[model samples]
Target: MTARTLPGMTTISYPPKPSPGDRIAVISAGAGLPGLLPRPFELGLERLRKEYDLVPVEYPATRKMGSTPQERAADIHAAFADPDIKAVIASIGGDDQITVLPFLDRELIRANPKPFFGMSDNTNLLAFLRNTGIVGYHGATVMCELGRPGAMHPQTADSLRAALFTSGAYELKPAERWNDINRDWADPATFEAEPETRPAAGWTWVNADRVVEGRSWGGCLEILGWLLMADREIPRDLAEFDGGVLLLETSEEMPSANEVFWTLRNMGERALLQRFSALLMGRAKTWSFERPNGPEEAARYAADQREAVLRAMRMYAPTTPIVFDVDFGHTDPQLVIPYGGLVRVDGPDRRITVTY
Candidate 1:
């Protein structure tokens, strides 16, 4: 194994409490699907009011389907800069949130920091917030968590509640039941009940024996690739990632195993892979509108993705423990992970936990 001194990841202090009756901003930093389909969006808002007991405030462009990057950035600034808004939540993930990153007013956000919640395309903003020394949340998008059909997934609800209300170490458990199949949001029946789920195959572990704890880093692997290409928020020194738990997930676009391996290989060439002590691989998202896979095909796809991850780890850091099929990405029952927060990877105990 390659040996190097570990540099400490930057720490961002969490904000004060936002109790019931406080206002939270709800913005669509990526896709404004709320305009196209209001069922899930409305349900998500209702849950914020009933379950969380916080009022959700929306922006002018929040529900606009084709909102421009400047418009979205304005909403972000307004939400963060406002003293009344205690938190900000994205409606859903989209394809071009990277474009909105450049337009963000860093000084404005730094002056007034609040907890931000999102994932997928929101990876761009999460990374941005981390760079700004603000602890942002990696999961729990409004539509996916609050608006979940039938009821909130128990795992998701618990994780999100802890991340939102409490501040401490929270253990992450592999979802006992998980779902990847989609129900059409356009169909009213889809909102009448929860989507079908299959028994979880459980997490796959590699190099299990020791415990590794570190500050967290990384986001959707695809989004990180874009950030690297654009020379965005990533630190130039590989040492910046040392002693850090790198969390990565693939988006619904479903890049092939070869592509995933190539991405990690490039990072390895840059001397980035060996710096991390452990990896949390988000459960592979197998089904999408473009390429809908059956159960057997979906299983194969997930297995292939795991093999690709192992191949890259073998070439980079052979001793690093990896826990796979974590439900924190494009999968249903997604748990919230704290970006730039402390994560403990207990290989001996087969437990993964994060401090939010």
Candidate 2:
């Protein structure tokens, strides 16, 4: 573990990164949707072996849909405690991840830290690892990004590979094309073609006049709200967030504009928003199986979500720089962001880079 310091963060330890041939743990620490929908999960494992040259080790509970928190927590402990496992990755994200928090052996995890990759509901574990002194990755799960239909997006593949094998400063680039709409993973046919995507414009900037560099924090906006309400692993000292770059994105659940506004509003009320030097709001996922929005409605939905974010920022962090539509959330072609790791947001040069 390399102990480092940023403006707002105390000493954060970045766990040693993995090499190409190292063994990686693929555990469904939150949900075992893999048992029900193995198409994507199996494809992801194949890619890990063939494309990435990493072997995946699964726990007994990895494919058990209704495993208890204790069972999942045991898998986590085992993954970290194993000397042969160079890294740990989640099979996918799920809503009940927050419930698994209490069962984690923080000391065991901290003592044997290895790069842990995940996002969405895995945000809970990411936040926990951050607090426990080990930096956790904020993107890339097996079934979602690696197991992407047809093939992994080149942009996403590049980001995940770097975050996994290399450790250095990596500059983030906007996706040439991107997608948030997903097909049913349950249907094997969905694996036959890549999801359709539209050309992506550059990220939107608000108050883009200066460059800000700091440690990154926050993830999966809805999961964050759950963590906050449950008073899970949030630091008692709000100062821990001061001068950090805030990272926030919603899930496929697609919370309404009003819900997004209220969540951020509540964070602002807690005096949290004002602590960040800059914010990276990920591209809002506009379509889901249930919503199946038309293009017009999808455009409106993204716009409204943007407005909702700006509304809360205006109230609590009026002048803070913000770059919207970063491709690092539930969106396809997602980029990996380091949790509790250094981020340099260059507004003047219109660049965003992360320390992988």
Per-model C-alpha lDDT, please? Answer: 0.87, 0.91
Per-residue lDDT of candidate 1, residues 1-356 (tens digit)? 11122234545666655777889999999999999988889999999999999999999888999999989999998999899999999999998888888788777887898889999989888888877778888998888778888899988988888888888889999888899878888888988888888899788888889999987788899998888777777765566678899999998899999999999998888788899999999999999989999889998999899899899999999999999998998898898998888899999889998988
Model 1 weakest lDDT span, ten residues long: 1-10
Cα error, candidate 2, residue 293 (Å): 0.4
Model 2, C-alpha of 249: deviation from truth (Å): 0.5
Model 2: lDDT to the true structure: 0.91
Show where candidate 1 strays beyond 4 Å.
1-11
lDDT of 1 at 215: 73
- Which pairs, if any, clash in model 1? none
In model 2, the runs with Cα more than 4 Å from the true position are: 1-9
